[model samples]
Target chain A: MNVHEPERRLVTLSDVARAAGVGESTVSRVLRNQGSFSKRTQDRVAEAVARLGYVPNRLAGMLAGSGSTAGAKLVGIIIPSLTNIVFPDLLRGANAALDHDGFQSVIGVSDYDPEREEALIGALLSWRPAGLIVTGLEHTAGAVARLRASGIRIVEMIDTDGDGLDIVVGFSNRGVGCDSARHLLARGYRRIGYVGHDITRDLRAAKRLAGFRETLREAGHPLAETEIAPGPSSAAAGRAALGRLLARRPDLHAVYFSNDDMALGGYFHCLAEGVAVPGRLALFGFNALDIAAAMPQPLTTIRTPRLEIGAVAVERLAADGPAETVDLGYELIAGATA
Target chain B: MNVHEPERRLVTLSDVARAAGVGESTVSRVLRNQGSFSKRTQDRVAEAVARLGYVPNRLAGMLAGSGSTAGAKLVGIIIPSLTNIVFPDLLRGANAALDHDGFQSVIGVSDYDPEREEALIGALLSWRPAGLIVTGLEHTAGAVARLRASGIRIVEMIDTDGDGLDIVVGFSNRGVGCDSARHLLARGYRRIGYVGHDITRDLRAAKRLAGFRETLREAGHPLAETEIAPGPSSAAAGRAALGRLLARRPDLHAVYFSNDDMALGGYFHCLAEGVAVPGRLALFGFNALDIAAAMPQPLTTIRTPRLEIGAVAVERLAADGPAETVDLGYELIAGATA
Candidate 1:
């Protein structure tokens, strides 16, 4: 449980060059090897560097001594979670663009905690990153204030309908929900239930549910029953919730899950219970994850452009100023389940 | 894309103090506010920090004033993948232990690339972490040499059979596979087929397959067929693999999958085709993931103590240098499927 503290001496390249008895340019050249330098100079510089135990300051190189007044080419990205494949694909696309432009990207996982997100922002800001990308627009009061006054460009991702700080990049979750409701209604399914997990934490899911209910009300049909899980949505929890819902409302004709994970659980439940899918009950899900399409009756769900959202967020950050909002639309993959 | 380069020199703590006409330590204390300081000092420090942008260096603070001596408190973790739920559960357990002891953990993902693992090791070493918790014992030549020479501590996690890199904390994948075969044989299910992703990338899965086959041969029941996927295991790929395997071996009595994802896909495939599970073909999986248990008919699989592995790995790294090996056994969960 020992906290291994960091070394604090500001050992500059000048000190290494002085110790090596070489010019500053010679030391820089030997270290970076970007310019021509004699082998002897390289050896001497290496020896001095090893002796002094100097770690070169990449930030200093990017910021200091530039005639033009431009900040360092760095971007900070913060995501809710990395356990899911969605965020990784996002990182992959953003990494490709950042690497191409020689921009260093520092990432922090908030684990869907707003306080943690704020703390992470403080850490990321310490590097003075040129731009910042966050998972969603919902933020703590302190977090919002700091981000507002930080003067750096900001980009909120994954949900675009919220009031943005500067740049917004994502799709409309509400629209996806309305579309899901209409699809289910058109199929003559009147008695429908809703299964979700922690709707408050995932604001987008709440919006989707709102839209779904609105559409149902307009059509003279109401949701059969709403079941909410205690925590993060998992396939197991989804299955259990669906089982409970079915027990309570046996007459339900279809179910709209908050996302694909829960819907998959519902699908599995029906299979285990020997209930014919679409004949006894139809199923719908969101976030057309890979598993959804591979299901026995492919899950009818909405596919968010996760990778594209990440890539476009970076591209917008790289633009001259902050972008107001970029609505990268979603896709509704019609599968057999619904 | 024009990179949104900032147009200003980043203000430092020293600049802030100078602007406020105060000592650097006073500003630091006021910002951190760990100890008592006058209200005037705090106000002046805040004003100075606001006037001149200054961000604290967390890395520098953690290391400042600490000498070159290594501490035995840190448990560094390196996992190959995060997409699977197994690793996150492991991290949760490990973090609980480390957090209780006031220890901080730093982690990196290898993405199944040995070279990337080696590079990540180098980056992790810069922090001078006390002990290393690597994924598998199979490391590249350079990585092995560096780890051996690093002289801190090493604990290879999630596998125990092959070789030892200091302390090994996991069960034998081969043993699990062999046991699975015995379970199926006792039930009179023969003409078995195997479905798996790239076994070479995941050496553990390969070992399991080998053990399963060996057991089957010993029992005079050979594998009728196997469907090998080209890349990482996914539900889509698993579904496709199952379809191909069934098309090739329609008479197969049972099928064993690399993990729960593949098993789930196979289950979905059977559901879609109206293939009676157990009556026609039984399905078995590994890891006993949460979803597997929640499935309509719980997945018949081996349950490895993934979270306990993580907790024990951290404990070993903190308590002892390394052991020859530590065997954390596996379990067989007989669900309705098999």
Candidate 2:
């Protein structure tokens, strides 16, 4: 088997110019319709471009005009993972907002690695995007430095716990944790446990845990047990972690999961094990995903304004405004689970 | 509030050269670490670049060098939607492979609109990506024309039902539907229903349904009912659609969902409504998602090689092999639900 070479050579602007019997500058002017050109010249250029199949390089066009930094209609978005539905929801909102404003997104997944985030930031900045949207407030020093030096609008999303470099659009993760603890406590579940995934990489999850613990401690009922599953957060991991946590502390009356995915897993475990939800053991979660509500016993969770956050981030990037935090806030759902 | 202007002007290569007391070409050579340059000149250029906060214009560099096509380390990926976990899984695999080879991805979402797909194709091609990966074989005539004329490697993913412009890497959607129908038939289900999302936009689902219907007809037991939700597939939509379908055709023995998300919703519906799954009614779905297995009674579904398709597409794009179709087959997971 031989490697497939490019089927045909790319038709250059020069080719269009030659075919149209006009200078390259005239061809460019006619195509861009920026400078004064006759109707006949424009027609000739268009016909030549169509016939030659010349796709104008926007990158070069932007550079030749006002530089990519000023004219490139691109946004760079870096997220932790796509496996979790939360990130996709965020992208959906961002993409819709961007599409409306005629901008395209160049995306990078950091995989919860600081080094990777730094590398991705450098790679993305090379495109000279109009703005950069990164997940959370936490980033490597190198990554932060690049964002600051890029001289473009920077929007840090999904967390507002720390100071942002420029624009910050998200609710506080710690606040979600606190609200969850308060909800569980209000329901009179004292012996509460925690089930989560890797918090080191998912810093927001860590913040949530810290807030939950603090809220629980303040309520004079500290966490009874904690089971943190290794690796990324998933339904299987949540299910397995819940089983282990229950095995360790059978007396635990409630469990606060890191998010809906893990909480759904816990819910599944309860159904399989015949543990009566909100009777034998209560459950609370974060991010009220669509599935969370559709379950037999709807999950008692915090519904972060995921889509709104994404949309607002884009709006802020486009709007001429001072850099400020836009906390869309979160809603605590009193579902049957708790 | 005043709009946030660019905090500072971008430091150009001219600034670096001026600071380094050298020509712009000398500064470029030193920074790229290409061509001959004196050690002292390199040191001076590096110092000036650091002092001036100069970020290199990779777009300009690529255009000036071998043009963006041969030199740009970018791959344009246009997926249908981010809301569906299936697309993200595909992207996750594709991104991992691309990252390993030092390639970045510029992504656009078509939202299952043919016109939008055509527009995105035009936009992506303007970047002059080394290769382009678009979802599915079905595209508008304009989109197909653009892909054929682009001259770069093109990868059509997720469905192998039609002819491709260049490389095709996916399993047959019709086969998946056929196999699923057979699975239900072998399980002794006669009066089977299909709960799905909009088949018009989701052509893959349409293919699956057509294949299922054809297979069932050949076996002398045609489908009993079909409930198609109006919007994109989601757990909520699935659950709602299942309710509507069962309400209309309570005599149905088994139900096939378009994908796991919809099936999961159907599962939830059963749990909520006390419908005895696989006892009074059996359930089958496609895409063996993580949550599918963790459910109380695991969902009997087909596990499409989503990740492998994405990874293989990238590998083929990078590989020096003749353009060909790769059939990465799927698996049928016979879980407790069916």
Candidate 3:
């Protein structure tokens, strides 16, 4: 109903053939390199395709069993948050690798909702992508079933906590949490608290909190006070969460945040309130985002292999192998804050 | 050729009709609300569709003579970068709006390459999305021709200097640049410098630089110095650009950066090198990003209406009418930097 007019048809193989002054069969053979074609014909067809900007419909060709199609090269990548630098960084790596490998990415944002993720997965699957790279292992049962039945390569990213449908590419979120707790404990911070968005909804953060509490229990410190804000983690949310935590327990030695956004917010709060950094309260966070190091006082945090994970995910998809996990571990940046 | 095995077919209208205990014609009539159908038939058919997850292929239906289907609900959103926080934030807003209206976004990243952008445009149009939302007004002639021929809702986003194919939704990059220059001049910074990435590739940045120079020339204070970095703007790149600018003209009173990323890097450079911000050298940038306000000193920069542009683009697509240009406008946040 919204159509203004009929679209001009796409430049097809026949058009390329006509433009190149060659038979359609010759053009197909040249494009596919299936049956032998002369060098002159190949050059002519290539030139014609360039002039026409003829991008073959790979999806349609894949379905039609055309010789010229290299099957499905489109990789469907679904992530949680685009505003969160982590997801974009992840896409950067995937895109770089995919571009080099002649693969295109069809991106879908789930907005941290598994039901949305499931719907997106179904839509992406309908397009018949070569691979589906989704954020985290957690998914609705329907999503899991669709993924398992799709036959396409599956790559679950960011959090490596559950069994993947096919391949998994990321470090252990739980380990990152436990390690943060240990780092704080080593710094002689007993009254360490937690500042993050709602963990139950964000399962990865939930895993981190569980690991953090587990380690704190071992150290007999326990979680001094916790502020779990109910929504997306942001610098503002982080600042507010920190404010709430401090109001309840002003003497908490330090706080472990869900991610760098919250940590940055907390850092801003300290700057705003003139709180002595480590002298009064130490701060630690996950995802050593670009801003972390550039800050006046660098944020002490864990840098996950976000880009590497994305790159490896695409690389694995290109390799076309059996199900396996590539544990690109996280790094600990011990800045002055902690 | 790379198929692991055969796949199941998409849910057909025939299947829905059979499941609903009606003929295919009745089902189509009920679904499209064309020929009259009993209320009972409509309910049964709708229930069957819901139970079957029958997403009618919009492109196919459009070709097959259906005024319904909205033709397509998938909006193809093309941007220059995924890592640039600005683009992501724009996408966040677009996605929210699109999702609210029961539409999905198919995102394509061109990484600031016009040729890539052209290719991506072709690929996106092949899918027959309801609308095409692209980053800038700049495009290769071939790309412009393709977009004009595509016959979908074409929205040129971010920059609004050139004539759009259909609807234009963004602020003027030149205006942003001129405003920043005027803002800096009012602060009495005569020996003004610029730290930026290669503007030739980022046409929007080029317009800003041109406008900045134009304003400076009118004021009889030609740009004192400039250091254009080679690639994408980053804090690291910003620091280096500032370093280069300072090495040549140490007495430069102020430096305007391409965007906030470079500005933040310059800010960090001053923080690390013990140079007093605004006292030793005033700093200014475009795109008042999130970290800008939350920083130790809020960044003095322009905040383009990124999210609003995205939201409005989709809204325009949904509304479907005559071509229009929306000047969402920009804001100059007079922070302590200048």
Candidate 4:
């Protein structure tokens, strides 16, 4: 409830200093564990603040554009889904940094929808965040307009292939895709197909697919058949799509999926139908999610640096002036299935 | 920035009604769309609201008791984690209902920690939500005490097994677990084990495990070995946990997982390691998430009514008279895995 009855004026650093019989700088130093201060003075300041129930205003710099304030410190983060593990990891990292700095994060969920990204840019602008971090470079007309118009610092995350907004942080989806294709192809897999869901929504997946296709084309071979589900990729859709694809082309030797979720489904389909993985057909996926490697044979995939992107974004946002992009890169994980 | 500069008073619903030359009741009805009104009158009300930039305060009832004219309706939502899909589905449903009522949802992530729940409840109380929808009935002493003291309406969601706070809306996790056990038993699988991730933190998963064990014990057999990952359930952890379990006890014929994520992991493991599902080992999981059914050999799972639970909680809050518990119920899906 935003009950407008004026709250009692909070005890400020000045009040704490006066109560402690010390200078404001001395009180600040003791609280921040920075400059050397007498033990007695530190205890006095601590006691004064506790007695006054003084919660520090952390966002001083952000709100005033000067001095140190915890609440005003900016922390930027980008995630594929607010409702997914990838986002949670990002949150964990950003939260750690932001909370430490007395900064809070304003997040936007892309929903894997580029149009929504454009809309979110406007929503985030109201807060006048010190910095901005977004999922990828793929943006709708409205999103690009606001991102360009909004003067706040920016960090583009997850995929670092395209032109950045201001600060770019993440790995290359296309490179990960190419690596996956080469690994599977080297295993004597020629009749390779692809199964994915809503590559149109997930620009990163589309990039990976493009890279995979480029690698296949260079090898003088084209993808045998591709199956795509209508909406967000899920294990069930992956299984259903793969089942249909295999039903149409039963002799397919290998298949590279958009992500581990789809590849997991394809694996399940093989498990159910008595078609051995890597024996009759090889399977590969991206985002070496925990389950991918945990699988019996392990999923050969790429591990994106989700949490680091968040942590680094916040770190950069809290630094000096104007923004810049940073690419953290990704890792190639070789599991049993590939 | 919490600027202290003076500004004109915000336009209220009464002003819009006056400006539109309509009765106050008429404005309320039109805004809520609860009663029948002529198109001409509706258009007038809409025009006046737009012209004045009137933001409706859905806190009419609560504001009557408070002294200030500046209060926003608080819709408090406490979820275990945003990482899982189930909670997101619930959140989306709640958001749809709350948005229409001009109520903003303030969320607290408990991270499956009861202590965190206690802390979050304390923080949420400061906002003074008109209603609170918390996940599950189990809570720490401090949390329960604070909630009881708040006197606001409370809704315990995602399970209806234990004593509720004020209102409870969810299905029975125990029933879901038992039914899964029964389904596997009916499929003639004798040797069974349980695979899950951190049941200690997730009370609902623990309930499911309890029911599964109880049913198995009633059926004249006990679990072979329960394998649990030390973290949140995921396909990767499920795969790893299943692999380790299998290596320890290769003769097990079936395994019941805490939820779909873990089950998916186990399924992937089967594909990677050349384990035959159903033939060599059957897999069962809870929460028939989208991917569960899409797998090539669909997984046998208990489908939870997630969206319904969320929507019903909001509906109960909007009714706003007394509180009670609701058991929405769950569905058992028989897929090829079992």
lDDT of 4 at B109: 71
Q: Which wins on DockQ, candidate 1 or candidate 2?
A: 2
Worst 10 residues of 3 chain B by lDDT: B58-67
Best by TM-score: 2
* Model 4, residue B232: C-alpha shift (Å): 3.4
True contacts kept of 3: 0.29
Query: Considering DockQ, which of the candidate structures 3 and 4 is the better prediction for this target?
Result: 3
Candidate 3: tens digits of C-alpha lDDT, residues B148-205: 7666789999888878878889999999989999998998899999999988889999
TM-score of candidate 3 relative to the true fold: 0.88
lDDT of 4 at A113: 65
Better of 1 and 4 by TM-score: 1
Q: Compare the candidates by DockQ and give the number of the best one.
A: 2
Clashes of each: 6, 6, 0, 20
How displaced is residue B184 in candidate 1, in Å? 2.4
Per-model TM-score, in order, reads 0.83, 0.93, 0.88, 0.75
Query: What interface RMSD does candidate 3 have?
Result: 4.4
DockQ versus reference, model 2: 0.58
Find the number of clashing residue pairs for candidate 4.
20
lDDT of candidate 3?
0.85
TM-score of 4: 0.75
**Higher-TM-score candidate of 1 and 2:** 2
The chain A TM-scores for the candidates, taken one by one, are: 0.85, 0.91, 0.93, 0.83
TM-score of chain B of each: 0.82, 0.91, 0.89, 0.83
